[model samples]
Each structure stands twice: as C-alpha cells, then as structure tokens.
Target: MHMADALISPAVAGTMYVCSAAAAGYSIKKVRMDTDTKKIPVMGIMGAFVFAAQMINFTIPGTGSSGHLCGGMLLSALLGPCAGFLTMIGVLLIQCLLFADGGLLALGCNVWNMAFYGCFIGALLIWRPMMKHSMTKKRIIISSILGCVLTLQLGAFSVSLETLASGITELPFLAFVATMQPIHLAIGLVEGCITAAVLVFVYEARPELLYAGEQANTRQNVFSFKKTLAILAITAAAIGGILSLFASSHPDGLEWSIEQLTGATELSASGGIYRMADTIQQATSILPDYAFSNSDSVFGTTFSGIFGGIVVIVLCVLVCRLFKFFSRKKSS
Candidate 1:
C-alpha cells in the first residue's frame, strides 16, 4: 500500500526519509567491506525483475482490488538480508522516480515498511536458521512461504501505524489496524505461495546457483554477476511478464478490504502530506512504469528496455568495482 504524500506530515516524511537513507547507506557500506563481487549482477538484475513483476496488478478472485508481487523477501532469501535490503532500495527508487508507483515523500515509509522488514526481519530471521539445515524441497518451500507471509503481515501493520501516527484518516487506530491486517493476511498468503514457487524452482533448477550465489555474494556479508543476471532476465520475461498476462482480474485483497471498510475503492487523503505525495507520484509515472505503452512507439519500447538493461549492467559493475577498491584499501 503506497502512502500518498497527502497521508503524511512533512515532519514524518522527512524523518522517515532520513532513517531509510541511513539504512541504505549502512547496507552499502557493509557490502563494500564484505568484498563479494558475485552479488552485484544478481542484485541489479533481481531489482529489475522485481520492477517487472510489480507491473501487472492481479485481482484476487472474488475481490475487486488488485495486488502485485513485492519481491523483497524472495530476494532476501537468495541474496541475504543486506544485499536484499540494498537492492530493494534500488527497486523502490526506480518505481518512485520512474514508475510513479509511490509518492516521493511517502517513498521512505514504503521502503521501510515493505523492503527493510522483508530483507532484515523476515528473510534473515527465517533464512539463517533454516538454510543451515538439510533444507529439503518441502522445508525450503514451506519456510520461504512463511517468511514471505510474515514480512507482508509486518509491513501491513507498519502502514497502519504510520498512517495513524500521521493523523491522516479519521479511522481509529484499532479500526485501521483491524481493517488493514486481515486483508493483508489474504494478500500475504498469495505472496507466500508465489514466493514458494520461485524458491522451489530455483532450488530444483540451480541448487548450486544458490550456493554459488551466496558464496559469490560478498555483501551476505552477498555478490553475483552475469549468470545471475541471465536468470533474472529469464525469470522476469517468463514468469513475471508472459505469465502475468493471465493473472486474475478481480480486486486485490487490499482494495477489496478498503472498499468494505471505507465504503470506497480508495480512501482519498485530504491532509497536506497526501497532496504532496500525489503530486510527486503524478510527476514520476509519466510513461510506462515497466513495459512500453501506447505512449511509447515500438522503437521507444525496444530502446527503453535496452537502455534499462545497459543501465542495470553498468550499475552492477560499478558497485562491484567500488567494493573491490574498498577491499584493496582495507587489506593494504
């Protein structure tokens, strides 16, 4: 759930922005120190994949609202908490500045609630304890699903808390929570199942890829390169893009719940915070958030994807080079 600029006060937004930025900075620092070069490509491509996956919002059957996959926990499962956390920042930044999915002011809160919790609390907590075991297919599937579900649940709670703290809605604290949590529970289940499927696929197809990925990722304290990028592209194209065309078209759990509770598909934000968020979102999402739209000609669409891929490749290489430099300096 993206919080509109109108939903939060400037103070709250500013504070959250500072906190999320600090966290991102900390993650980057840790990655640099760790010296895992393999993770860079993995992080970049996975970020792109998340971007692609989040594009088509699928309506849960029987619900009028739609939901899309948020890949934070899934990434965390493969990339570890720190790399997962940092990559999430990259994904959210793309979504905010380019896709206009969430408001600029409200972006800090969205990242913190959705990504940070998933990477740090949800993925790390579950992955670390579970990965050491024999990690059978069933166990891996079940655990990944649970981690995904827990993260989303926590994220939904954070949103409710943040909204109330901002004093945006007239709904009481308990009322807001009561409305948010259960619906997210439904959403979380869907996310968990999808996460499990991805995890299982990776487990079966590229067991060593995961092993190699974790070993190569200096940032685990994680790193990866072209191999991971290839997987990311294939998965995004196959599962995220092609498969998404056939996803359900009913309202997602969140929207459905909002409609039931608020009597509207969306509750308009009247506060100053919401207004600022709306303005920023409109500014960011001027064109295709992920794919080429009618606004973009065929040539434009091809150009954008190529340009996007090149940008991702460059960023991955740069991050890796920076880390190597830091490692050399530290060792020297």
Candidate 2:
C-alpha cells in the first residue's frame, strides 16, 4: 500500500528514510562490487516487469478489493538478494516520482516497508533455506506464498507502527496494526500466487537462470532480444493508464482498513510540518489523490506508469551496463 505523505510524521518517516537508504546502498554495493555484472540486464528488465505487474492489481475474487504483485522475493530468488534489493529501489523510485503512486517525502519509508524486508530478509531467510530441500514446483509455490505473506504482513504492520510511533495519528499503535495487517495478508496471498506463476514460468523455460545464479560469480549475459522485458514494461504502463479509469472510487486497501475500523476514512493532514510541502505538491499535482477534475480523462494517470517503467528500465540498464563495462575493463 502506498502510504501518503499525510499519514506519516517526519521523524518516523525520516528514520525509515535513512534506514531504507542505508539498506539500498548496501544492497547496491553487495551486488555491484561482489557479483558478476553480466546479470545487470536481467535486473533492469525484471525491475520494469515488476513495475508493470504492480500496475495490474487484480481484484480479489468476491471481496471487491484489489491487490497487485509486489515481486520482491521472486526477483531475489531469480536474481539473487543484492540485485533484487536494488531492483526494488529502482521500482519504488518510478512509483513515487513519476507515477506519483507514493509521495516524494514518503518514498523512503515506502521503499523500506515494501522493498527492504522482502528483498533482503525474504530471500535470505525464507527462500534460500526452503530451496535447499526442494526446488520443485510445489515447494517454490508454497515458499513464495509464505514469503510474500510474511513480507507484506510485516511491512503493513511497520506502516501502522511507524505512524503510531510518530504520534502523528490519534489511532492507537496496536489498533493501527490490527487495521492494516489482515488486508495485506490477503494481498500477500495474491502476490504469492503471482510470484509463483512467474517464477514457475521462468524455472520451466529457463532453469538455467536460477541455476546460473547459484554460480553467482559467473552469471551469463542474456541480453539478446529479450522482447519479454520490453513487452512487460509496455504492458505495465498500459495497465496503469487503463486502471486509473476504474480505480475503485472507494478507498484502497489501507484507507479501506482504516475506514472499516474507525467508521471514517479521511484523516486530517493539517498537523504535520510537511504540510507546506504537501500543499505545494497538491497545487502542482493535477490529480493529487489520483483524480482529474477539469481535464478530460485522457490527461489522467498520464504516462507515469509507462514513463516510470522507462525511467526504471533505463536507470537499471545504465547501472548494469556500467557494472558490466567496468568489470570487463578490470579483467582486461
């Protein structure tokens, strides 16, 4: 869930921001300095794929609520933990700035809550241990669902805890967590299935990708055509544009959770110091809460998803290409 700038306090947000930045920096270093650079293209394309997949949040059957793929552990399992972490950072950046999926000030917290645990912990703790006994379809599916559920559940709880710790909301700490976690549990199941599906596809068609990752020192370059990556990015952008049209007029997962618990959904954003910044952004953002009033629907959602996908893919590619180039230069 994209925590709005309104929901978080500067202290809590700033703390998480620092933590997220540190973790992201560490992840990049782990991947860049330690791992082979040939895998960069895979990381970039997969980052875009995650962006696109997130855009297509499928409505949970019979619930009238929706959830999207988070793609963290899946990326890690496929790409290794370090690359997955950096890829997630790239994805979150696209979502926050270009898509306005999450606010600029709140980006760090969002990244930490959503990406850090999933990429690092999910991969290192859950997936790796489980994969030792079995890489079977059943095992991968079960592990993915479990890992994703735990990750989202943890992140959602962190959001509740962070906001409560900040003393930003009148909501009680346990109360906020209670409100957030269950819905995300449901969301996590969806993520689990989607991740398993993608992983299964890759595993079946190209087990070499995962097998190669075991030899982390010698990941082969798979940069030819790879049209799937480009197609996925385009598809994700299109889904974002299309979904902006039908985004439940009702509050989303987090907002809905708050509403169900409190009997009211709207929280006042007036008290925080970030208010001025929020105001300036509100003024500039044509669709602050993702709605366009004056302009025709065409202007809505704009191309941010597509634009974001492009930015993420390009940045990832550049980072990867640089890693590859330099690695080659050193070896030569």
- Tell me the tens digit of each residue's lDDT in model 1 across 181-248: 77777777777787778766666555544522442223221223344457667766554435555555
Candidate 2, poorest ten consecutive residues by summed lDDT:
211-220
Rate residue 80 of model 1 by lDDT.
75
Q: How accurate is candidate 2 locally (lDDT)?
A: 0.70
Instruction: Provide TM-scores for the models.
Output: 0.81, 0.83
Give the Å shift of residue 276 in candidate 1. 5.5
Q: Can you tell me which runs of candidate 2 are displaced by over 4 Å? A: 61-64, 211-250, 263-266, 279-302, 321-332
Cα-based lDDT at residue 61, candidate 2: 61
Model 1 TM-score relative to the real fold: 0.81
- Give the Cα error of residue 282 in candidate 2, in Å: 5.4
